[model samples]
Target: MEVAEVQKQYIRELLIKGRKIEAIKYLRTNFDLTLRDAKRLAELIDEDIADDEYIKRPGPFSGGGVAILTIVFGLVGVIMLGVAIHLYTSNRSFVREAEQTVAIVVSNPSQPVFEYEINGQTYTYYSNVESDPPSYSMGEEVPIYVNPSNPNDVLINTFMDRWFLISLLGGMGVIFLGVSMLVFFAARAR
Candidate 1:
């Protein structure tokens, strides 16, 4: 098939940007050419633009530094994912052995203080987490998880309280790994 003028221009641009593989794939898809033919045409376009003074082509190592940085970020993401998995498993076991109870917010300074009754005795608990708008208000009732053996060991039963950290770390890990893969592919194009 005879390549259109516009297609030729686009292929040349792709080659100049060090996307020869993409240019070849484009030809195979749009022009319905065989893989070998598409590769040959893309190489021809690359050679045609090799000496064009106005069009600057990327060096062989153009995105090498960015690829290396992304790899480091990906490694950090893997570590975060590992930590998240560990926290999730540990929290799951704790939840399974925990007992549920209703607690009232007694104070709301920086962290909310909760009061609950167990076995006809009153126990007071303080939230370790602090939020800007505050998760609880004074006089609000909330459900909590507690170790039956040790009433002092307690946790808020809300989903956010139980899984927020794990979710955040897992999300960040996936994003970093995805970005690393994209960067690595772009660098290889050079």
Candidate 2:
């Protein structure tokens, strides 16, 4: 016979009442619990723990290696972000002192396309709509955005490089598949 949850609770209560020996006997007779199980359960209740959930073990490709690589990239990205921030902060004075040059919106033909020259490099930014450039002139000055530390760090156009992200995921998937194949072959060999 299988022991019910309520019966288990009743046994637990008896064990907590300092009648552990009696509880074990009752559990063995009524619930048909083994002496070891009754004793272990009683101990758990005495310690105020509800239950234990067993965790299933992971095989080699729980795909944790891909996650590890992603973590490495994230760490590198954080370092890059820090470097950019520092450059911006340190070059603030230089940027303020440098002459701001205006580049006309050649594409929009009507909007102001501002260009800033810093560190012998030309940095450009569009006004208001940085994501989308409105039609306008070759010499029109809209607005120029620049990095305070390094002017070379810039956005040349509004286009997004989605291929980079796709390539990264594809690379990780290929690596995982390769590693899994290796593990499979190695296991077969053994």
Candidate 3:
């Protein structure tokens, strides 16, 4: 909204009284100006009036949108972490009874694809199914654990294969929680 001449004069008076930050906050509340625009306008007012009243101040970080986003991100991270933990435990249990064999890395265009033989039957597998990084070179031999009941079910024998999802989701959770804490504390500081 366009500020009336009287309102503009009042804003200038506020700036002259060393209330430039308050003037900007007032502009943000009363006008349609963004925070950046309000700050810039407040600074311009000080420059034009030859006053040193304008002092940059940090704005509020707390908002409903930020709170909602923090909750959503934190919840998703927790859910992913939970799934990873569950799969890791299940894989561990299976590995205790599963058969171990060597699988040869056959090809990798986007993800690694490998094959192994069990009882004269060749089984093809994609590394993307495990979400493990494609660290294997072509023809490289890697150990894998295959479920005894279902030969098709397998797990790569590596620390990353076991804990990758857990680490990823935990890291994301920490980051989201950290952001939320920063916003929460910064708002409270004011």
Candidate 4:
């Protein structure tokens, strides 16, 4: 496809701004060119404007900086995965020994407090997880698992209450790890 004058100007601007990848992507999408052709066109545009004093060229350590950042993200992903695993195992152990009972919501919506009876004694404890638009209304009855020896130790008998944090951390870890891998491979290919 023939490049329009406006497209060429935009490509030149992208190159001047050190956004070669974006320029290549624009050429691929707008011009219906193969990756190799788009990349070649972008590089040609970059060379055409190499002498322009306004261009902010990348420094020698730019690639190294990206590699270092990718490594840091990978490390964070590993740490998050580790914490998720620990929480999952700990929650599993707690649920194994906990007794089930129905508890009434006694406190405000944002910070729900549960009240339950064991034998002739009553116990009220704040839920560990709090939600906006409140998960439970006041006086609402919810099934919960409570430690027999310590009534204050409670877990709401719902997948979200017990597993939300684990799922969130694990999902973020996977995403970070996936992105890091893709960047690493792409850099290596270049």
Per-residue lDDT over 43-155 for candidate 1, one digit per residue giving the tens place of the 0 to 100 score: 88777875653355555345477756876988988988888899899888887998888999999745889999877778999888887788778888899888888988888
Q: List the residue pairs that clash in candidate 1.
A: none
Off by over 4 Å in 1: 1-64
Task: Provide C-alpha RMSD values for all models, in order.
Answer: 8.0, 14.0, 11.9, 9.8
lDDT of each: 0.83, 0.53, 0.77, 0.85
Candidate scoring better on TM-score of 2 and 4: 4
Mark the regions of model 3 whose C-alpha exceeds 4 Å error after superposition: 1-63, 107-110, 129-134, 185-190
lDDT rank order: 4, 1, 3, 2
User: How many steric clashes does model 2 contain?
Assistant: 19
Model 3 / residue 133 / CA error / Å: 11
**Lowest summed lDDT window (length 10), candidate 2:** 155-164
For lDDT, candidate 1 versus 4, the one ahead is 4
lDDT of 3 by residue, 55-157 (tens): 4444453446756765676676567667667776777798899999999989882377889998889999887643346577789988999987898898888
Per-prediction TM-score: 0.64, 0.29, 0.51, 0.64
**Candidate 2, residues 1-190: lDDT per residue as tens digits?**
4667897777767755556788778867776689998777667655763334223344443557744555555555555545545544545544454444444464443344456666666555544433335344466443333545556443322222213333454455556555555555554453
